[model samples]
Target chain A: MNKELVEKIKNDPNYQELVSKRSSFSIKLTIAMLAVYFAFILTIAFKPALLGTPLSADSVTTVGIPVGIAVIIFAFILTGIYTKRANTEFDDLTNKIKNAIKEH
Target chain B: MNRTFLFLVLGSIAVFASGAIEGEVQKQALNMSAIVMFLIFVSATLGITYWAAKRTKSAKDFYTAGGGITGFQNGMAIAGDYMSAASFLGISGLVYMKGYDGLIYSIGFLVGWPIILFMIAEPLRNLGKYTFADVASYRLRQTPIRTLAASGSIATVVLYLIAQMVGAGKLIELLFGLNYEVAVILVGVLMILYVTFGGMLATTWVQIIKAFLLLSGASFMAIAVMAHYDFSFGALFTHATELKGIAIMSPGGLVSDPISAISLAIALMFGTAGLPHILMRFFTVSDAKEARKSVFYATGFIGYFYILTFIIGFGAIVMVFKNPAYLDVVKNAVDGTSPILGGSNMAAIHLSHAVGGDFFLGFISAVAFATILAVVSGLTLAGASAISHDLYASVIKRGNVDSMKEMRVSKIATVILGIVAIIMGIMFEKQNIAFVVGLAFAIAASANFPILVLSMYWRKLTTRGAVVGGSLGLATAILLVILSPTVWVKILGYKTAIFPYEHPALFSVAVAFIAIWFFSITDKSENAKEEQEAFEAQYIRSQTGIGAEGASH
Candidate 1:
């Protein structure tokens, strides 16, 4: 470990913010995905008849089709959502903290 | 990148056109177009290996490709590494056989990508140098932790390698009319060549190429399938229901009960995060940002690929179900129902023929073989690294060995693994490849995932806790799997299973977590205290990416 960088990162407020914000944000997103995934899995476990219901009165497609697709598409959307925040918010704080340490 | 895509597109079109002409005649058992297409792919990959071998000089280059790969490239390689024969042939076949149940598997496989992205990817890139053990052993005693982690990795990799090798053998024999032993040897030798000579670079490139071919081939099949019904998914679904039944639109008999479904879900979700070969891909990138970006790209590509497979599966239900041309007439004699030429695994292949003809079938068969080769190479490299880097260099020599010597040992380990895989693959050819892969995932999720997550996030985790808990998890998973229905009754010919469930993750993971909590908190040893204090350094490093090895550049 580099003693200087470790100490600097430990003492910086921006570093603290980066850690907290990123952790909370990731945790939130994780919970969201898990909620959807577990809901689907539990439905499959307990009442699969719910998934078996038709999407429309006349349609042959089941509700599970779009629901499953939504789960997958939601994964892509969440990744994009995280990357959008990370590349902007998190990367900015990291660069600021690194620069602050360098100047000192 | 453009050049690679262009070559793939042109090559596929040529195969498609040639296959259309070949499809006009009665279907031959041995399709020459598939053989020629496979030869082209093999020669192309071998050329890449020759080029990569020249640049692979040191241990760093051998293990992590000199950390030169960008995010997009590593993402492609990761997708390539992940989309195994099971995902391609197995998933589509499931969909072809049992309609809505297949999507459940696709969802289970895809959901893990997002979890990995949210939690594991960036920290993993920051903490580890070469292997997942590097991260797990950061605050613990290196030798013991490395030994446990390496054993877990080797077990997972060998099981996965055998499954992939057997799949390749069966697929090749079906497609090219070759012997299973010959096919297994071909796959095994090719994997050893990629790992021993070109190392990670060759394996990554091979995976990327195979990913491209599979995506394109599957995409074409989906498009062709949609075109058959005027490109309407609604029409596709309607036709599928009309052909099979109304119930085909929903979940079927795959998930027996709540316990097994949830247990299988747990294994699939966490297992991806713990797989050694997949985690090792992060180190090939330059930084945590690249690792993060790689996951984003991987999730997008993998999600899209799963959707295409859904379309291909439903397409097969409509197209390949009753078609006599693709059916085995003799099997129909026993059942009075039309079955596909091979088992359900041939659904995607037969669908390709129904849509594009023999050339397209040839192209897909080649891509399937390529998928097996790419996955096996990644598994073999991870296993070799466990033996050489973790066991030989770190444990035996205490990190005092020459880098060149370590690389040499890795190459030798690769050869030995290749031979072992060939033998095990042949022995397990008659066994259920899917069941074997499930055991690998269960061990990984139960043993590796619990320890890895606790080490990264928990401050109280001691060296003893990790070792004891990890071993318990590993042992419990293996024991429970043996006693479970899949192995006990099916494999060992028993009347009833000691453990009634099919999956062991629900029990094994809980045991690991409980043991970790108990051992880590109760132990008051000086070593435990030191490990607890060192967690601050490890946490800061994992979070801020400071003092991370190879991060200076």
Candidate 2:
């Protein structure tokens, strides 16, 4: 690509907005995921019996089953949130940036 | 022409059938249903390959199906690539054997997808063409960076191939009652045909179909298991706890220590983003929007699939573990404990028969075989792209090679990779290969992931830093694996491991980041300055998709 176009896009406020919003959003989501996963892993490492405890006194199922499945579901949910925002909000900013460059 | 291809496929199947019959007479009764189902799957895939071959006229078409795949389709294909035979059988088998411990792996694997979607997927789609090396080498020195990326890709691919191949051979032996060598050869041959002729389009279709079949089959098994318990997981777990004890509901010996747990978690998480086959799936979409969408769908499908496998595992524990019919009585008598017919890895396979009978067993067996073919084909294509697109086209020829020549080179590489996979599969048949996949993940997380991430994110990453840091990370990961317990104690017959932990990603990734930071800041070269300056354009393209290859309609 030409230098002028890149410079123009780089300096565009929409591009800046898109980059900052997306990066922060992604970083937050990433931190959330790592936190959840590492929490689960650490729990497994240090306190195995905690997860082994049944839901109720008479219950056969342990707490780990739902917890593990929750982590998986949380991951999917996080992806959904990101995709929804990226396709709608961030993508709008990107299109504005592109249009600005084209008109120039 | 179609008739000729059909004849060729049938002729090969005939030869394999004869060999299987001769080999199985000494083992046990032949599984005619499995063989028939497998033949049908193989014939259908071969027909898809024949069709894809017609449309694959350009290098772009060969690599990314001309970027024509929709978001949802690419999502299914990505899920197909991720849900290999290893994850399906291996994780379920772990659950069957160790109970709640298996969920650790499932969670680790699923967690990578969200991270990939959040960070890597869009930038990757906005930047690269064909292989991931395109992104890594975007502003850096092409030759060294491409060389490094290709080495990492090939190493990851070959290691993963060996694991998949060995597992395929053994699983087919138990499931199809076929000879191990025949099974390996069958996988290698089918992979070669799919990739060499059909390219990305065929590979994607094959993966999607296999993913669909596997999901449906596993769903059926899970539903069947739940049906027996009135659709209550509590009832199922109650039975499992009664049979296997309550210890099965908690963590076992898989990750006993804190460091090992964290190290393994890191490897499983980032190693996925570094995987070439998975990363390559991004470019198959038309734009970054589709790329993002694909990950969303892939994560959901994969997470749902893992949940099914967990159910299947617990189901197997309750159904197949105590059943005398599925147990090998002689072995059980000697061991004083009932063991399933083909070991714990066959837990899901045995559960298929217990729950769904011979016909369903035949279907699951075929699906498992198809899963292997799909995974290996994806691996082979990635490896070939590394060799041809990165090494031959860009590095060796200085990006001057014609598309046709590059395509031919990739085809040749695919054939070579297939042969090597088959041979290695046979060679490693008796050896313990459980560590191979882990090592692949380690290398990917350490080497490929660091450089790719740094090149895109770190403004000061020079060619020197990337080459030095990536090579050190790669070397360290491999070296640590060699000195770790899995290899040193188990394979090499050493009494004690030099590396205390089995996983090396934590240390190796730290080394890579530190080394890259150290080298890039210390460098005083004019070229380094220019590379730093070039990052703005690369970043713009990465963020905004301006000047991105194949983005223009």
| Angstrom error at residue B192, model 1 | 0.9
Q: Which docking class does model 2 fall in?
A: high
* Residue lDDT tens for model 2, B392-468: 99999999989999999999999999999999989977776656777888899999999999988999999999999
C-alpha RMSD of each candidate structure in angstroms: 7.1, 7.6
lDDT of 2 at B13: 17
- Model 2 regions more than 4 Å off: B1-28, B551-553
Residue B368 displacement (Å), model 1: 0.6
Which digits, one per residue and each the tens of the lDDT, describe model 1 over residues B220-264? 999999988898778898888888888778776656466776777
lDDT of 2 at B285: 91
> What is candidate 1's fraction of native contacts?
0.76
